[model samples]
Target: MSTTPLVLLHAFPLDSRMWDGLTEPLARRARLITPDQRGLGTATLPDTGAAPSLDDAADDVLAQLDQLGIDRAVVGGCSMGGYLTMAVLRKAPERVSGLVFIDTKAGADTDEARANRLTTAERVMREGHQGWLAENMMSVLVGPTTHAERPEVLARVRELVDAQPPAGIAWALRAMADRPDSTATLRAADVPALVIMGAEDQLTPMAEATAMVDALPNATLATVQGAGHLSPLEDPESVAKTVLDWLP
Candidate 1:
């Protein structure tokens, strides 16, 4: 197997810790780097007064690669991480050797969705807490199978969500709300791609996964059984197996 580094970006309101389960297995195959995006985990939000931009987030990822002396890598992400993956592809396509998109779509948010995200960001900032996200997002984040059989996973997810700083969460919401449609980018991508989705992922279901597969000239879809939007966390074994099989 090739040893090209694999950079796995995390989901929204989550950190690099989300990939903990896949780390060891994947590391045996290739070098793995899971950096916490700005304002999310241990990373501090820059004091810059500028607005949130996925492009800037992408730049941050690329800059990290620069610091590490990695010239190229396979970039992949889940949900919000997927958005950032596309941003990186757009901002610096030459740096990416492959693409892995999990439980995410290539289209921009609908107007209503954008507005809702903006509203939520405002509410979280105003309230100075992210309890609402922790309370409301659990059901949507994991699938019914997880909810019924994996209560521990749900509790772990809640802890991860609750631990995130409100500022980071709010900034991520705004950045995601403004992300552009990446269908064209995928269509033009020259690298191999793997699009994975949870079997029961309601947020970006089979249709979304298939759409990405169809768009990529060289891509395949892997649906994780008994998982949802956060499939990596809900069913890491299956996800890791699929990814390991796909990796070169």
Candidate 2:
């Protein structure tokens, strides 16, 4: 088996700590690098009054890899982190040995979605992540099963969301709003790809996940039952098992 490193990127607004559940198990199998994107967690970057592009975020990952002396690795991400993963594949395909996309879409935001993201960016900047989390945390982050059966998971999600920096949240919103469609990038990638989704992920539903799976030349889809957008948090065991089974 190849001993290439594995880089797992976290979802939006949350930092690398969001992957805590899967970290130990996955780390036993391979070297794992989970860096916080700019302005999130302890990773700080100067805010230039404009949102950084996905390419910029990808560059951050590349720079981190260089600093760690890793030449190539399996790269994967969840949500906004998935966007950065695709951007990395586009910008530096040589650095990627495999790909994993979790609960994310290959398409760019629609006009309405982009507008809403911008509006959200403004709101997060003005009122902070608390207001945004208050409105979206319970309803949008996890699935119905989590809502009905997993109060502990919900609490953990709350903690991760609460720890986010407002500036980082706003920056992520704007970056996602302006991100380009990555369907073409997905189509062109020739490496092994694993697409994992929560069965109840309303944000990126089954149809979207199916589309992503169909687009890739070599890809497999794993749907985690009883989970939602934050599947890693909602059902970390299943996510880790699926990922570990698929990894080389």
lDDT of 2 by residue, 72-159 (tens): 9899999988999999999999999899999999999999999988898888888787745644756977899999999998777777
What residue runs in model 2 are displaced by over 4 Å at the alpha carbon?
48-51
Q: How far is candidate 1 from the true structure (C-alpha RMSD, Å)?
A: 0.9
- Candidate RMSDs in Å, in order, are 0.9, 1.4
**Pairing residues by index, what is the TM-score of model 1?**
0.98
- Top candidate by lDDT: 1
- Which pairs clash in model 1? none
Model 1 agreement with the true structure over 190-221: per-residue lDDT tens digits:
99999999999988879989999999999989
What is the Å distance of residue 147 in model 2 from its true position? 0.5
Q: Which residue pairs overlap in candidate 2's backbone?
A: none
lDDT for model 1: 0.92
